[model samples]
Target: MVNVEVIATEELGDRSYLAHDGSVAVAVDPQRDIDRVEALLSALGLTLELVVETHIHNDYVTGGRQLATRTGARYVVNAEDPVAFDRVPVRAGDEIAVGAMTVRVVATPGHTFTHLSYVISDGDPAAAPAVFTGGSLLYGSVGRTDLVDPARTDELTRAQYHSVRHLAESLPGETAVYPTHGFGSFCSAAPTTGGPSGTIADERARNDAVLEPDEDAFVARLVAGLTAYPAYYAHMAPVNLRGPAPVDLSPLPVLDPAELAARIDAGEWVVDLRDRTAYAAQHLTGSVGIGLGPQFATWLGWVIPWDTPLTLIGESAEQVADAQRQLVRIGIDRPRGRATGTIDALADGRPTRSYPTATFDELRTARGEDPVIVDVRRDDEYAVAHIRGALHIPLPELADRLHELPDRRLWVHCQSAYRASIGASLLDRAGFDVVLVADEFPHAQELGLTD
Candidate 1:
């Protein structure tokens, strides 16, 4: 029997796997991590035959075209959309054969008009099937309807409900179901906190949206709970559709401190992905800071321009490589070069300083001091209300308007500590003394800020 090995994308936390039958392999929803996929393919010694994109993903730039180009594999997508790749346009009822395995495409378009789920079956008619449901069907929820035309929210909602029903009724009860996304992803409302793969029967029992028969009600519930899409999504969709120019990662001329300063003064952000303390002491002028911490990949993706070329300032060569890998995970492709002799390069010139941050209690104590409290959470979270006198900057917009912040003590907070930490760190690196509020506010009343 052929074996399928699923690999989660580094940044997406979504499932992208390789299905192989000894001699040939097919990749599903490949992320931008080409090296990792290549390594896996090399280890398996199987020729890559096909790349199947389940839908047009908006969250991160896809690597399907890149993978197909490198491996000479056919790129497959739903026949409805003219996806830019070596073409194998699959439609509902079409079956693609890879060696001894057969993949049947099922049009499942609630997530987007072109979403397709593939059912993989062994060539033997008696063998059961496994479905790669992409974003169309998830463990406990359906893909959000607002991703497409806002006016057709209802129609898309109906489509999703029927899609779930169709999968449930048509696929055998024992068919394995694997989804592309999981919890902590923006794609679905109720994401599975478990692994990348599950079964149709398990999802049918546990997934609330999948179990619901009333299409309109399901749509209403899903739409009501959607978090705001990241600003990157707006740019990534069209870029992916049209295909971006090949990224050039060749080393650029190493800039001296003066040249780096001039670039920073010209409004180019120098992101130092070293440790917080190193960034705190010395960095290029106007460089917003993020470290190679746990949330490094996420904050980098959130704050930096996807198209912008990054001049990485790392403490060591290893850190620079780590930073590069992190950036690539989220599809940030234009890495200009790493600053060698990082400390020595800045020793002859003035090093930029970082900002200071305050704690929740410090915010409370200094409430009367009139410090500007910037809540970096999204507007929807702020609509539920925020600390009194807190300005809503949203982490994604913080880099653009750092000058708007008054030259006073700045305090920042988000739902949990994650975003606030990132914002505070950036502000700190950009020369603002900011404090992160570590307390979790269960209700609006807990926030002691004034209106």
Candidate 2:
């Protein structure tokens, strides 16, 4: 029996797995940095026989080519993918042998036109299979069919329904299900509402895509549930099809306060990777505060233009390097320089700005001032229920919709205070008088602030 270890990318909430038999190992859907995968191989003392990609990923660049080149492992991707790179093309029903284990390719096209899932078996004909569903069937929902094209949404949604059922019927109830996009990834039809990996029995019993009575209802529900994803997603397919350039992780030059100020003045992105609250308290004016958290890279990729140069602003070298690693995973690797502890320098003489963090009750009292309440939550969350007349500008769209915002005090809020602080910081930098409604959104309803 082989053992499976999941390598999770916290920034994107993505999962890549390594499956190893006694002598050989296979890495599935690895992120761009091959160091983690190589470390695993060296630690296990097993030779990497293959590196497989389940699909043309539209979220992060894959490290299959690099891993293969570095480790002399054969690279495998679906034959249908129009990738310009060289690799062994896999088709549905094609099986690759790795020592005592067998990886059977299963074509599951819903997330993208060329998506594939790998079923790993112990080579015993009757042994139950373990499936890597890779955005096909997720924890409770399935992959969003709209990532490719809006016109193909209906067709892809139907295909997703059948593909999910195909896995359920072909695999045994005890078969383990591993998904690459889990833990709040935007690639899913809905956020994965349950724990990481579930068994076939558990999914068949609980997953809405599997349990829905008809495909039409499933498609309608799933399609309607999808909200805006990062705009960087559009570039992912072509980049993956061709190939991503190797990430450069060499130490970036540390910019002095004056040099950093010049970059900020020149309208370059000087991202402040601090906690949201800390950022709200005080930050260098014009620095965009994208807190160094799980979703930092996702939002940064979404808001920052693809070719724009970036300069990171953080408190420590560790924080800046960690941000760099997160940025490279999503292919935003052109950080020109970084500045650390600008806040400490500003504390003595230079100017710094802070925004007021208001609770729900406090917002109610201030409502008479007629602040422009900008709800930076996802559109689906806004539709579910939100404060009446709160302007809906998802965090991803906030950068482009600045002209549409009213010229009054902008009070920003999301489901939680995290996004609100980000929105508030953006608004503040854009010269708007900003106030952050820092309480939970549900607390608004509890306090009679929302309809």
Candidate 3:
């Protein structure tokens, strides 16, 4: 088999692959940032001969078109995709020859109407091939069916069941399976088993799609398990289809304290990009603290109104630039302004606020005080396990439903404290007494906080 390198964008829970034969390479499902890919190609002394898109992705902007243009490689996409760009379109039963690799296309239309899987081998028919199953057959699960068209969820789920069975039966059991989603992406249907890498045999043994004999049952189970996804997902496909411009990661215009305060007063978003602990100690009164981390872009894009004039506050320009890269992946193309300095400097002696952060044990201590408990996890997470008396307002919905909260002090939490920290900030900004439960969920059970 040709040598394959997996490049993971852990923050987005997606992986892009580069396969080569010591001379030429093929890139699959690349993210918007092309520098990473170019760096890999230069390091390996391999020329990128082909860049492929498994489908018009609905999770993040694709860099295939731009990468192809810059490298002068042939950009290949499904012939059936209605993207607004020129490409070398191929269909099922077509095969392409690279240096020592042969790429065979297979139709796997469950993830989207035109999704394709690429099986690659190094000319030896006996050698097990590697299949790049973009969003079709994941580790032990499949790609979610609702993103393309929610109304067609049930129909697409049925298609997903059959497509998975087809792949398992057609390919060798030892064939290596590389999926692009399911690490933590909402685009992936949570499978029964997951690993860093898997094979067809492993999936055949444990995958729900292959194990479930009845198609209708598989469809129903898959559909029933679906949950809410990020609001930014709705824009990824359109941006991909319209053709994304080359990404720009340059520093943004600096905003002084006076301008930052003016933006907040004008009802614009001025988000703090510091860590949660530092934010809890001290933060600008009106700025919402969604700390800079893996989930920062996900929560920030979800809670803020789309296209709002946004300003970011960080302790350094590097922090703000990192946030900008994550934002561009989800189609939050630009930040209106930015500030990089200490909270004290950004505050410029203006009003500042701080809140208390506690664990489940501390929460129990404050129970007699009767503080409102709010669970900000998604419906699926809360449904599986949660404290009995806690209010269930998901983080995505919390900003919109603030008026529904009681005027009492509220304690906010999630599966982990990442989301809870963000929820606490929003509540604090709205003039509520907020205590962030900055710990894991298992502690709640240990402390007898769960029902």
Alpha-carbon TM-score of each model against the true structure? 0.88, 0.95, 0.97
Between prediction 1 and prediction 2, the one with superior lDDT is 2
The collision pairs in model 1 are 355-428, 355-432, 356-433, 356-434, 357-434, 357-435, 358-435, 388-449, 388-450
Superposed model 1: Cα runs more than 4 Å off: 193-196, 244-253, 293-298, 305-309, 329-331, 340-347, 368-370, 383-385, 399-407, 425-433, 436-451
Candidate 3 lDDT, 1-451, residue by residue in tens: 6799989998888999998888999999998988999999999999999998888999899989999999999999999888788999999989998789988899999899899999989998778889999999999999999999999888889888988999999999999998999888888887436668899999899789999999988998898988898998888889898899888888899999999999989988899999899999999988899999988888898888888989999989999999999998888878998998888898898999999999999898988887789999999888888997899999999989998899888999998899999999999988899999999999999888887
Best TM-score among the predictions, by candidate number: 3
- Candidate 3 runs further than 4 Å off: 191-194
- Any idea what lDDT model 3 has? 0.90
Q: Summarize candidate 1's per-residue lDDT along 1-451 as a digit string, tens digits.
A: 4477877654555778788887898888877766678899999898999899888887767778788888999989766775564468878999888888888899887888888998888776666678888888887677777776879877887888888778988887778877887645677755564454577787778776666767677777777777876556666667677655554444444667776666667766677776545554555656766777656776777687666656766666677776666565456765665565665465456654554444566677787778788899888888886787788899999879898999977777887766776687678756677766655645334555534
What's model 3's TM-score?
Answer: 0.97
lDDT, candidate 2, 274-340, per-residue tens: 8887888888888888899888888888888787779998889899988888888888876999877
Q: After superposition, how far is residue 328 of candidate 3 from its true place, in Å?
A: 1.5
Q: What is the C-alpha lDDT of each candidate?
A: 0.73, 0.85, 0.90
